[model samples]
Target: MATMEWIAACREELYALREELHRCPELSHQEYRTSALIEKQLRAWGIPVLDFHLETGVVAKISGGHSGKLLVLREDIDALPIQENTGLPFSSQVSGVCHACGHDIHTTALLGAARLLSEHRDQLHGDVLLVFQCAEESFDGAASMLAHGIFSAQTPNAVVGFHCAPQLQVGKVEISAGIREASCDSLTLTVVGKGGHGAHPDECIDPVVMSAGLLMQLQTLVSRRNKATDPVVLTFGEIHGGSAPNVIPDQVLLRGTLRTFDNRVRMAHLAALEDLCTGFCRALGGTCTVTVEKSLPPLINSPDICQQLLTSAQTVLGEDCLGSESAPSMGSDDFSCMLEACGNHGAQYLVGTGLENDPATRMGLHVAENIFPSQAIEPAAATLVQFALDYLN
Candidate 1:
């Protein structure tokens, strides 16, 4: 079939898959229905589904007619906790749950690629592993799958995954090498102090005052302590203290995230945060406890894998679809855990998707309330399929 005709024939199926997933969005380890849907489809396509040691994920292997190196393609199958506001016909039906991050699109693209490749297995040169991972929204899923022996079982020479970008134009692919995303650390700080009556100013230690001071000092770390060239973001996303304005609460809780591209910078930021919190609480005659949870390492793409992706993308979608080297983002991805597990096995990782450059239209990461157009599905699937074919050949 001609390329246009082939894509057009598959378009409805792909969009239907995306819509189905979007309507019934699940979060993290709670993707039982989603996993089953993907598994059933792969089985129907005649692909061999492996026993996913991780309970909430699926891995389907398609070995080519001739023996060669193994290649892996991954798609995260978890949705965010945001409520849907897109108003699309296929918008999330589950209240307070949605695929705002485009995992539905990624999953659909990979499933389409898997079906196409399985049908053309006789023309392939090596084995292919289609990995549908869960709990990418959390820090545990990739590490959980890796620890359960998925990477060792497949032992692929290269692995690739992509995310949808609302900023990029429809039907285009954006590629970036090196540090594509930052390390993420979620921190919760509790400041304990003495409570007092609303009119008694001298009796209370005022933990709220200390918490505000600490928040201000945290921002200065990026501006004064870190190098100008280094990218670091310290955000205090939430704060909770007294219930009523008249009451001087005994404790205040502060929650935020830390993002950085450099390991040294990440460490430095953590150390500074600890010191600042401790010092500020002590000065205010209050006790403070800070907990860092769900931390993920920075995503660094392997050089060889990136080059292979560039070549594959250029061959399939032409040079105009490829993007220049862009700076690393402050976002975090669970794929970093997969890369860490397969790093010893000579695995290379890369990302391809759409990104829009307009700042006004861009929403917050993952938790935003919007729907990116479904036009990216075919192009992404085609690029991945062609890349796998090129690698296997």
Candidate 2:
């Protein structure tokens, strides 16, 4: 079979595999069964599963017919923490967790590409690296896999990954050349101060008072400092301080998330935030600590690579089906972290799985009712395989 025909022939098995993944969705960093299934599937096809020191996910390699540049195709194999309410027969068997982000499709599509690539190795000039990475929802999978040396032995010349886009209809995909995804920094700010009676005005440093002021000023980093055109989001989802209403707590914990589109702006804002927090707290006779758990870097698509994928997508979906040009999103994918490992020569695309008439299928990712139509699998898989052939050949 030709490059695209391979996926069409294997659609039935691809559907079954995706459903199998959807039914037993696994959470980030806990994808033992998912990883095992991937390992079994890849090994069954004579592909070599690399001996990496990863706790979850599988990394396999497909050697081309000859020596050339390496290409890495990654797929996230983890689910979200949401409960399944899609009402499908293959609804998530695991309660309180589901593959609402369409990772089932992502994993299965990549698997389909593996099957096609395995058959069409003669068309490729270089090896293809398959990264079924884990812990994407936690935003630490790519970084953790790097720490474990997933790419230490075999670094690719370019990388590619895909995510489901609920807004676009099935058979369509979106790709851009620059800043496709944002940088995320999960932050925990601890406001430390003297504990005393709430009634005490002078003796108690009052962390509650300090936290309130800090939260208000944190907004200024985006509004007062950064360029208005470049978007930034700083949101706090949790705040815990005192147990008693009459007592002033010694410490207040503020947990928030920061998102930026540019890495240069991201770094500057991070430093500015720490300085602002420290100075603001000390000026009020208190100390504040900002513990930033960095998640993902800005996802930048290589211009040359995007041009190649555009041709690949055109072959599968036609030119009219290509999405209209749009600006990049503030969303972050852990795949961005792996881009740095590959010398920043990669791009991740948004594969549209939404149906125009089916509201449930069109629901945004991470929502309990979000589900993808099975029709999305074959074409998505074919596009990826074609991109590999186009770039490497």
Q: What do the candidate models score in CA lDDT, each in turn? A: 0.79, 0.89
Instruction: List ranges where model 1 is wrong by over 4 Å.
Output: 1-9, 53-55, 122-125, 199-204, 323-326, 344-371
Predict model 2's lDDT versus the native: 0.89
Please give, for residues 275-374, the per-residue lDDT of candidate 1 as tens digits: 8888878988998888998778888887777677777777766778765445567878878777766662222223333346534225644645555667
Q: Tens digits of per-residue lDDT for model 2 on 280-339? A: 999999999999996688888999888889989888778865776567878788899989
Clash pairs for candidate 1? 167-355, 167-356, 168-355, 168-356
Residue 297, model 1: lDDT of 81
Lowest summed lDDT window (length 10), candidate 1: 344-353
Q: After superposition, how far is residue 320 of candidate 1 from its true place, in Å?
A: 2.6
Error of 2 at 52 (Å): 1.0
Mark the regions of model 2 whose C-alpha exceeds 4 Å error after superposition: none
Q: What is the clash count of model 1?
A: 4
